[model samples]
Target chain A: MEINHTVIDSVPILAVSGRIDATTSRDLENALNGLIEEDNNRIIVDLAGVEYISSVGLRVMLAALKKVRPKQGDLMLASLQPFVREVFEITGFTKLFLICPDQREAISKMKTG
Target chain B: MMGINREITVPARLGEIPAISDFIYEVMSACGFDAKKIMEMQLAAEEACTNISNYAYEERNGQIHITAAAEDDLHLTLEDWGTPFDPTSRIAPVTESPAEERPIGGLGIYLIKNCVDEIHYQHRDGKNILKLVKNKD
Candidate 1:
C-alpha cells in the first residue's frame, strides 16, 4: 500500500492506496506507529485510494486504536471503498473505531471533537 | 456455464499472497461468480494462506496448493504440508464485545467461515486440506 502523509489543519491524514494485505500491513503498522509517536496519536487514515483491506489490516488498525485511545487520541478512517467498507462491517470494525464518510468529515471530527 | 478447474502451488509465504489471490479471483470470476462473492472468497483464501504463511510451517519453508473447481457450486481447496492444525476448529471471536476487551487477533477463521456457504477440514496423507464451497444460485 502507498501512504501519503499530509497535515491538514495539524491533523495528520494518511492517504493510503492499493491493497493492504498480509505483506503490506507491516508498512501501514510502521506508518501508524511513527505518526502516533510524532503526531500525539491524533491521526486520520484517508482510505479513499485503498480498494481492498483484509483482516490483517483490521488487526493493525485495531492495535493502533487501542494504543491511541488511552492517550486521549483517536484514529479515524475516511472514504473507504465499498469492498473495504464491507470488510470492516463484516468484521465489526465499524463499531470499534470512528469511520467517517470523507476526508473533510474526518478532519472536521478531529478538529472539532 | 461451470466446468472450470484451476490449481496452483506457491510457497507458503506472505509475499506470495497476491499471486494466490489473483489466481483465485480469475478462476472465481470465470466461474460466473459475482464481484462480491469473488471478493469474499479472496478474503477467505488470504486468511487461510496468512495462517499458513505465519504459523503453519513454523520456522520452515513449505508450499500451499490451491485448487478451484467450478461444478454445481464453486469449490476451493487449500492443501498445506505444514504443521497439522484444524483451522476450522478455532472459535469465533466475540465481535459484540467492546474493542478494548477484544483480543488483537484471531479473526482469520471467523472471517473465512463467513465468506462461504460451507467449510470442511481434514488431515489426511500428511496434508491439511480445507475445502470451501459457495453455492451458485
Candidate 2:
C-alpha cells in the first residue's frame, strides 16, 4: 500500500491507497505508529482509495486502535469501499472504530466529538 | 508434479495477490462454475495466499506456488518455502463470543475452511503446501 499523510488543522489524516494485504501491512503499521507518537494519538484513516484488505491488514488496524485507545485517542475510518467494508464488518471492527460513510463526516465527527 | 494439470508460481508478496486470485477464478469459472462458486473459491485461495505472504516468509523473501486443476472438480493449491506453519491447525474462531471479543487472525483461515469442499495441508521437503478443493458436481 502507498500512504500519504497530511495534517488537517493539526489532526493527522492518513490517505492510504492500493491493497493492504500481507506484504503492505508493515508500511501501514509504521505510518500509523509515526502519527500516533508524533500527534496526540487521534487519527483519521481515509480508506476510500484502498481497494482490498486481508486479515494481516486487519491486524495492523487492530494494533493501531489498541495503541491509541489507552491514550484516550482514536483511529477512525472514512469511506470504505464495499469489499473493504465487508472485511471490517465480518471482523467486528466496524463497532470498534468510528466508521463514517464519507470522509467529510469522519473528519467532522473527529472535530466535533 | 512437473506436469501437473495446471499450476502457477508467484512471489510471496502482496503485490501478486490480485494476479493470483484472477488466475484461479478465471480457470474455475471456465470449468462451468457459477459466479458464487467462483467468488467462494477466490476468497479461500486469497486467504491462503495472504497467510503465506505474512507468516511463511517472516523477514525473508520467498515465492508461493499456486496450482489449479479442473478435472471432475476444481482444485487450487498454494505452496510456500518458508516457516513451517499450518494455518488450519490454529485455534478455531471463537463462535460463542461476539466479534469484538474474538481474536483477529484466525477468522480468515476459518472462513477458507468453511468455503471449500476439501482442505488439505502438508509440509514436504521444506515446502508448505495447502490445497483447497471445490467440487463442480
Candidate 3:
C-alpha cells in the first residue's frame, strides 16, 4: 500500500492506494499513528485508490478513530470504492465515521467541526 | 462437479495474502462471478487464509494449500497443518455496538461468514480444512 500525505486546511489527508489487508494494514496504522503523534488530530483518508480491505484494515481505522475522538478530533474517510464501501456497510462502520463522496466534502465537514 | 479446478500452496505468512487473493479473483472471475461477487469471495477467502497465516502454525513455519473449484457455485478449500481451530465456532461480533465498545478482533471470521453462502470446517489427518462456497448466480 502507498499513502500520499497532504494537508488540507491543517487537517492531514492521506491518499491511500492499493490493497489494505492483514499484511498491509501495518503501513496504514503507522501512517495514521505518525499523524496522531504529530498532534494532527483531524485527518482524512482518501480511499479512491484502495481496491480491497479486510478486517485488519478496519481494525486500524477503528483504533485511529478511538484515539482521535477523545481529543475532539476525527478521522474521516472519502471516495470509497463500491466494494470497499460495502465492507464498511456490512461491518456497520458507516455509522461510526463521517464518510463523504469526495475529498472536498470530507474536508468541508472537518472544517465545520 | 465443475471442470475448472486450480490449486496453490503458499507460506503461511501475511505477505502471501495478496497472491492468494489474486488467485481467488482469477478463478472466481473465470467461474463467471461479477466484480461484486468476486470481491466478496476474495474477501472471504482472504479472511480464512489470514487466520491460518496468523494462528495455524504457532511459531513454526508452515504452508497453506488452497484448492478452488467451480461448477454452478464457487468452492474454495484451505488446508493447513497448523493447530486445530474451527472458525465457524467463533461467535459473530455485535455489529450494532457503538464504536467505543467494539472489539478489534473477531471481525475477520464474521466477515467470512457473512460474505460467503456457506462454510464448513473439519480436522482430519492433522490438517485443518476450511471450505467456503459461494453461488455464482
Candidate 4:
C-alpha cells in the first residue's frame, strides 16, 4: 500500500492507496502509531484510494483509535470506497469513528471542535 | 455455464497472503463475479487463509493448499496439515458494542462469516480442511 502524509489545517491526513490486508496492515499500523507517538492526535485517514481492507486493517485502525482517544484526539475517516465502506458497516465500525464525505468536511469538523 | 477449477499451495506465512488473494481474485473474476462480490470473496479468503498461516502451523513451517472451483457457485477449500481448528465454531463478535468496548480478535472470522454464503470445516486424515462457498444466483 502507498501512504501519503500531509497536513490539512494542522491535522495530519494520511491518504492510503492499495489493498490493506494482513500483508500490508503493518505498514499502516506503523504509520498511524508513528503519528500518535509524535503527539499528533487528531488525524484523518483518506480511504478514497484504498480498494480493499480486511480485518487486519480494521484492527490497526481500532488500535490507533484506542491510542488517540486518550489524548483527546480522534482518527476520522473520509472518502471510503464502496467495498471498503461495506466492511466498516458490516463490522459496525461506521458508528465507532467520525466519517465524512471528503477531506474538507473532516478538516472543517476538526477545526470546529 | 462451464465449470472451472484451480488450486495453489503457499507457505503458511503472512507474506504469502497477497499471492493467495491474487489467486482468489483471478479465479473469482474468471467466474464472472462482479467487482463488489470479487472484493468480498477476496476479503473472506484472505481472512481464512491468514488464520491458517498464522495459527495452524505454530512455530513450524507448513503449507496451505487452496483450491477454487466455480460452477453454480464459487467454492474455495483450504487444506493444511497443521493443528486442527474450526474457524466457524467461534461465535460472531458483537457488532453493536461501542468501539472501545469491542474486542479485536474475533473480527477475522466474523468477516469470513459475513462475506460468504456458506462455510464448513472438517478434520480428515490429520488435515484441517475449510470450505467456503459463495452463491452467484
Looking at model 3, the pairs that clash are: none
Candidates sorted by TM-score, best first = 4, 3, 1, 2
Candidate 3 structure lDDT: 0.87
- Give one digit per residue, the lDDT tens place, for model 1 in A12-113: 889999999988999999999998877568899999998878888998999999899999899999999999998887778898889999999999999988
* Model with the higher DockQ, candidate 1 or 3: 3
lDDT of 3 by residue, B4-100 (tens): 8999999888788889888988888777788888889889988887778666776468999999888789889999999997888874666577634
Q: Tens digit of lDDT per residue, candidate 2, span A1-113? A: 68989878767888999878655788999999887777558899999898777777887888899999898888899989877786676666787789988777877888888
Candidate 2 residue A30 Cα shift, in angstroms, is 2.0
Sorted into a CAPRI-style docking class, model 2 comes out as acceptable
For A1-113, candidate 4 gives per-residue lDDT tens digits of 99999997789999999999888999999999999989999999999999999988988998999899998999999999999999999888898889999989999998887
Best by TM-score: 4
Clashes by residue pair, model 4 = none
Could you give candidate 3's per-residue lDDT for residues A32-101 as a string of tens digits? Answer: 9999999988999999999889988998999999999999999999999989998998888899899999
Estimate every model's Cα lDDT from 0 to 1. 0.85, 0.78, 0.87, 0.87
lDDT of 4 by residue, B5-119 (tens): 9999988888888888889888888888888888888898888877786667773699999999998789999999998878877646665666445333367788888899999
Supply candidate 1's per-residue lDDT for B74. Answer: 85
Q: Which stretches of candidate 2 lie over 4 Å from their true place?
A: B1-5, B10-43, B50-63, B70-74, B80-86, B94-105, B114-118, B121-129, B134-137
Best by DockQ: 4
Worst 10 residues of 2 chain B by lDDT: B96-105
Those runs of model 1 whose alpha carbons end farther than 4 Å from true positions after fitting are B93-95, B98-105
Error of 1 at A27 (Å): 1.7
